[model samples]
Target: MTLAVLLLVSSALPAQAASNRAKQRKLTDTQTLFTKAMRWGEFEQAWSVVDPKARESRGLTGLELSRYKQVEVTGYSEIGSMSEPDDIVVRVIEMRVVNRNTMAERTLRVRERWRWDEADGQWWLQDGLPDLWQGQ
Candidate 1:
């Protein structure tokens, strides 16, 4: 009975590990799409990856989204990332932007928080859109 239990447990381990890898790949792909959209000033596409609840809470108006167009994303780099407890991941991204109106440039580090939603079967950006205007 002990050997049989051990065999079953050992068989399950590989499956669990593979599941984790698949989840990581999905997250990577989603992140890439979000990054690409942001880099190209496609806020609508990037907004699709954000957590629905977060979007709802923000009560974003059309003017709010139009603000993103005022700045051009010159560069975006992922500085670092850390996985926290409860299926949460935090990534630090350094973004360089130039204001279309003023031609002034600035670099800002944005913290992107992600959470795995089992019901949704995917990862969602917990942090809403980065406020490029914040502190400016």
Candidate 2:
């Protein structure tokens, strides 16, 4: 019985490890999509990643229209991430943005929430610009 129990535990360990890796990969993918949308000025693309409730609350259409203006994203760095069964919270350490004409770069630390929608088999932004580095 002891030998059988040990065998069962050994088999379970690999499955749990794989599950954790999958969750991490999903979180990374979600973060990548967000950065890509910002870099390309694809607000609609970004909006597509947002939860429906957040979309409505923030007037997604207006946000998309406003993003028609030119903007540049220099880089993104992941500060950390926390995982839930169906969601992930990521803290970005470095996000650099530049205005088209001003040629000035602004770097900020931002935190965002991403959700995994099992029904759609996709990950999406569930919240927005929750906090800035300097309270601005």
Q: Find the candidate with the highest lDDT and give its number.
A: 1
List ranges where model 1 is wrong by over 4 Å.
none
Task: Output the number of the TM-score-best candidate.
Answer: 1
lDDT of 2: 0.68
Q: RMSD to the native, candidate 2?
A: 3.7
Report clash pairs, candidate 1. Answer: none
Q: After superposition, how far is residue 134 of candidate 1 from its true place, in Å?
A: 1.6
lDDT of 1 by residue, 16-115 (tens): 9999998999999999999999999999989999999998998567997888989899999999999999999999999999999999999999999999
**Alpha-carbon RMSD of each model:** 1.0, 3.7
Q: How far is candidate 1 from the true structure (C-alpha RMSD, Å)?
A: 1.0
Sequence-dependent TM-score of model 1: 0.96
Candidate 2 per-residue lDDT, tens place, 1-136, comes to 9999999999999999997688678867866787787667666676677787777787655644654454576766777767655455555457777767787778877767777776776677777532322543
